[model samples]
Target: DDMTDPVADSARSLLDGHVVLSRKLAELGHYPAVDPLASVSRLMNSVVSKEHLLASQRFKAIYATYQGAEDMINIGALAPGANRRIDRAVSLIDRVNEFLLQPIGQRCEFQQTVKWLLDITKSWDFLLPAEQDLPPEVPAGPNEADA
Candidate 1:
């Protein structure tokens, strides 16, 4: 529980703290007509909200796919598939890191960069443990008892 996954944790931190936050800030500047002060205030409030904090925790847990974690999927059981997915995730993160290293205001390809970040996060959901992978319960079924 107290253990740390340096690789995954670092990647998650960079993605959340650097990539995501930076993108949000950049978006606020895209349109000059919007009140900068209000936009920034709203953004700051959302960042500190309970919902955002909980989501950040969930994201960190998902990204921390290290082996031997009790709540995590058994990496050994799905080594080949897991490794492939992790590699892709790391590659996308690396690309983001590289893009961030560029001089400020010089970065382009916003759509592609955003797409990569979205893809990376979306893919992590698949690597969750089997129990967590189950679809949400529904009331509709063959019979009320089955529901």
Candidate 2:
């Protein structure tokens, strides 16, 4: 299965940044002493707004590559291993979605969830393999093995 290394690298970098930012916030006690929930809300708002945009962009780029490969196959190109890459990308997107759905609050649970996400982000470099090979063109049709 051929994976797109650039897309993976981008995701890794974004997640790493998120982890670093979260740690910095925690160390600085940026969550207001007067109202921790307010601070968390503000942080979540930034996550939902700015960070999500980058996540969406990365997913879109990956999805576009998958779609392009399909288009190539429809045009009789010999591309292979696109489905595997698409599957991996979909899994990554699912993880992001799951993380986004977690409730926001000042509770230890919330903080732990954030820390868990940071850990996951930090470990993305290890999750993906280092190398993948892409064929020059799409195969004749959808490979049943991919299904």
Segments in model 2 whose C-alpha atoms lie over 4 Å from true places: 1-80, 83-85, 103-111, 126-147
The estimated TM-scores of all candidates read 0.27, 0.28
Question: Per-residue lDDT for 1-147 in model 1, tens only?
Answer: 111568756655555232223344356453222222112232433546564444333334333433123223333443334454444444344433343344546656855654544544454444456655344567676687765
User: Where is the poorest 10-residue window by lDDT in model 1?
Assistant: 31-40
* lDDT by residue (tens digit), candidate 2, 1-147: 112478755765555232213343345554321221111122444566454434334544444444445456567664345445554544464454444342346354755664545543432332244344333464556675576
Give the number of colliding residue pairs in candidate 1: 0
lDDT (C-alpha) at residue 27 in model 2: 57
- TM for candidate 1 is 0.27
